[model samples]
Target: MYVGIDHSTTGIKVAAIGDDGELTTAFRIDRRNVETAGAFLEVLDDRIGLSRVSLATVTYAFGNAIDEIEGIEDVPNRGTTDLVGLDYGTGAGATVFDRLYDSAVPTVVLPGVHRGLDTLHAFFRHYSALAGADKVASMRYALERFRAEFDASGAFIWVCASSSCMAGLVCGGRLTGFFHWVGPVHGWPDPEAVRRGVESDFEDVFMRCGLLPRRGADLTDVHDIADRDLLQSVYWSTLMNVYALYPFARDLGADGLDAVVLSGRLMRRERPFPLGRRVYEACVDLAPVRFAEPYTSAQGAALVARDVAAGADEVLGIPVGDVPGGRDR
Candidate 1:
């Protein structure tokens, strides 16, 4: 069995793949309540026998084997980029990694993209996972959807939803070297900020963003304002952040590509909430836009696992198990 874990900003997700490569069991847990390594094993034990499992892969908590994005470097590391190996007791990945190590199970860690310039050239690269955590971004998901419908290939732009939202390019199964930047503290807008443009007051629109504080109130039958103006503000914010990384995309225009896709928790909403819709609509004209729901980084991790287990020469320039680095290049 192959185990894939996504240490996302929201929670820890564990998925087990069957021998035939089908998804077996998947579970999610809050990032905070993890008390010790035993808690992780307990969860795995319930899903499948630990001894039967062979390979386990985790995302976002490990060190960067290839940290730079293909072309951009100004954006600093956020989220797990600063913490490699999950050894820090405070970092969420640390507890998870520690537990996995204690089990004496074979494991592999994923890396994030970083920005750095070539010593000999004026060019820069946004180094990250070969496919950026092996997850589909908005554009990649859209391309899959678009190809299914149109029977054609096209370029795409994607933004992943994790602790920090990262945008990249995807075309012909290859991701972009360029991407935009925004960490939680820097990119996520305050609810009050979303309300500024709407006729509704800040509190009125802030609640509409689907994030609300729990106050132990027996409140039921709430309302979703669906305010047009509030939605537009959120839309603009998403686009601008992505556009901020446009230079990297231009640098990697090796193939003709144009279009956008929306992926992430924001894409999962059934109704095109104001923020989500605006972002989608704004980019629709750029190319035919599409939506891919239930974004799962684990899918990417599983793909990488399959590749590594087969003895890939390189996974984004880092050695995979015993494979020598740069052999794939």
Candidate 2:
């Protein structure tokens, strides 16, 4: 058995997979969670019998200076360096790396693609950095379940989650360039702006512009778009895509791409404000288009972990690190 751990925006999730490709109850903890290694091992001992586990894979922010996972230190916070860099000082996922390492089990830490390391694939590195290691886990899981229905081969995906919208490419049997649109501090703007416009004292000006939030809890109604808030997502998304595309394209390659995929909470909203449609419309004029499954990162990370334990070369076209000590050098 092997364990794949996803360090997500919301929690630290670990999944145990059997040799036959079965997934047991995946365990998770809040980003702020801190526990002694012994206590954590006890929990794993009771739930899935960690003693039988042969390998563990985890993705989280060790630090901006963390070129390889070996230099990662156990800071007293969550992966807040990015957030704190942006002035959102909660330090949520920092302790995760320490706690997991304390288990003293054989483990592999995935590198966040960064130009600092002089990585050949820095573009994908940044996006995965934003999504963290967990999203990779989720995407792998989602791909395994939906592979028959979608053509994920030689494709790039754009995902929108709670705080940001991210885009990535899978090619050559490895995760390529991934870019984070939202900065360390501000995050994604359209959602927060829409929420603020909903509750602002400037309702008169907003109403004059026919802007408002979803009425009475029903987001699918025409009123949703008629209101200024949702209507504005169209403009905001357009601006975001325009700015995001350049960096994204640079990561993919100068020759261009085969297809584009869009997925995220905002994209899944009842009111389709033409963000994906616009991106597709814009990109389709230049290339082909594809849609990705929601919640793919979490699923993908888990599947990647399973494959890593089996010594596989690629998971859904995303190249993974070899064994626990394979990349240690």
Candidate 3:
């Protein structure tokens, strides 16, 4: 079996995939509940049968320190350049990374999309970072989803709308650009938010500047917000973010998007309003839009582990590294 670990904003998610590429087990652990790596491993063993894992692919925060998929031991600073504003709860991600490094399971870490990556278009180098490693994993799944469902492989955009909104473009089968959450328009921050971040603290600004938070909505219970007006605002904001990516996609030489894959916690919610369907309808005119499962990132990571163990050299344009004992699989 192959395993994938996603250290997300609210929790640590693990997904195990059998040799046939079928999902066998999946679970999420609250960051607050797992203070130590031992605690995390114990929970993982209980839920996914750790002893049976052949290879485990893990994603931590930022992932800007490296540009290739590398073994856990080969990465520096746990695959990050800095930890600013990443101390979610109990620093569980750090604990999980450290423990996985010393564990018996062969593990590899993924890099985030950033200026340092040579695969991206030169225009995207204006920003320092685009998305995290989990986003790359998500893009991997989106690529497969696009090919499997839409039967096209030209180009596509993956839009993730959750606590924050961001989009990535895959053109010519390579990750070429991204619409990051830090941008001024339709992203997490507006001019007002930038001013507020300057006044108070910019560390946590990204988490506090989304459309929901800007409208004074509670993020902890985002799915529970009953205000139709607020939901409409969020729906339109997400649509606008998607709309903003079309020109960029075309500029990168994509005739047009083969499809647009939508994923994230918000895209899966149905309460108060059918936000996911609304967003999909808004974009159906542009291209085929598909909803991805919530476990997409982890599942994609599992696929990565499987392919790397099978001696594949690259995944979705991201180069693979020599994973010490991985080829033995």
Candidate 4:
């Protein structure tokens, strides 16, 4: 069995996969459960049975520093030297990475596709510096494994719609470029708040930026776009993410795009908000759009680990490092 770990803004997500990325078991350990490696282990408990994980794929932080997928121990600064660059719950992610690094199981770390490494294109300049690695893992996992799961193939534009909306492309099986847009949901500093010295740190402000927290208890449970103004904003933000990335996708080769994949908490499995559906409807002009399972980064990362363990040099066309004998170099 192989495991994939996604240390994201909220918590540490883990996925155990059988052959060909078939998800066997999955759970999310709260951020509070991962303050330290020992604490993390206690949180994991028997839920994961880490000892059984023959190969583990872990993703952390901007993923900017590391170009290729690498071994956990081999990653630089947990895969990025620029620590203070972006704060998307990175401290928690790093702690989780350290936990995997010290473990007996072989851990493969995936890189965050960015201007720093993937391609120095004008479109992928500064904004992608600290785009979460989980999104990259999701993109690769979606494309590389989409064929098996859906019997679909070819290039596609993937939008990770969450507190933040990030859209990118996989052209010819390669992640070419992307656009990052953070909605008011991820929080932006209110000039008045900053003026009153409310909070200086953007991350702190950004954490409170989501629409759910901004709303009261009554509307908290409301998921419909019609009643909730928050969902309207969210719907607009998500749509813009697709609109922004459509150009990049088209530039890469619109003709090759097989589909547009949306993955995130907003794309609820049970019922998609009408506004969100409308937003995607607009995006259909570019290509047929669909929502993949949420938190696919973990599954994708597991797939990478599985493929690498089988002596594959790449996962979903993303070249991974050669960890000889599954030992850290």
Please name the candidate that would achieve the greatest lDDT relative to the true structure.
Answer: 3
Query: Which ranking of candidates, highest lDDT first?
Result: 3, 4, 2, 1
Q: List TM-scores for all candidates, in order.
A: 0.63, 0.58, 0.88, 0.80
Give the clash count for model 3.
Answer: 0
Candidate 1 lDDT over residue span 200-243, tens digit each: 44322212332221222211212232334433433454577556
CA lDDT of each prediction against the hidden true structure: 0.47, 0.47, 0.77, 0.66
In TM-score terms, which candidate is top?
3
lDDT at position 5, candidate 3: 91
lDDT of 2 at 250: 43
Residue pairs clashing in model 4 are: 185-209, 185-210, 187-209
Off-target runs (Cα >4 Å) in candidate 1 are 18-21, 36-38, 65-89, 116-154, 161-163, 178-180, 183-234, 244-251, 270-272, 315-329
Model 4: ten consecutive residues of lowest lDDT: 216-225
Q: Candidate 2 lDDT, tens digit per residue, 1-329? A: 76766544445556776766566567665544433232455556677676776766666642343333331233223432353223213233335455566766666555444443333364444422344555455445544554454443343444443334455545433455555544211233355455665676332222122122223333233312334354344436433543455455445553454445555544444444544555556666544565655435544554555566566654544344434623322
Ranking by TM-score: 3, 4, 1, 2
**Among all windows of ten consecutive residues in candidate 2, which has the lowest summed lDDT?**
205-214
Per-residue lDDT for 1-329 in model 3, tens only?
99999877567888888888888987888876776434888888888777898888998877999988899989999888876544342377878888899888789998898888888878888877777898888888777655655333478889887655678888776787877653111244567767987797666666666555566656655545566666666677677767877888778766787888998877776777788899898899999888888788888888888878887777777888888546743
Candidate 4, 267-312: lDDT as tens digits: 6623434554665777787767777876588888777777778777
How displaced is residue 13 in candidate 3, in Å? Answer: 1.1
Whichever of 3 and 4 has more lDDT, that candidate is 3
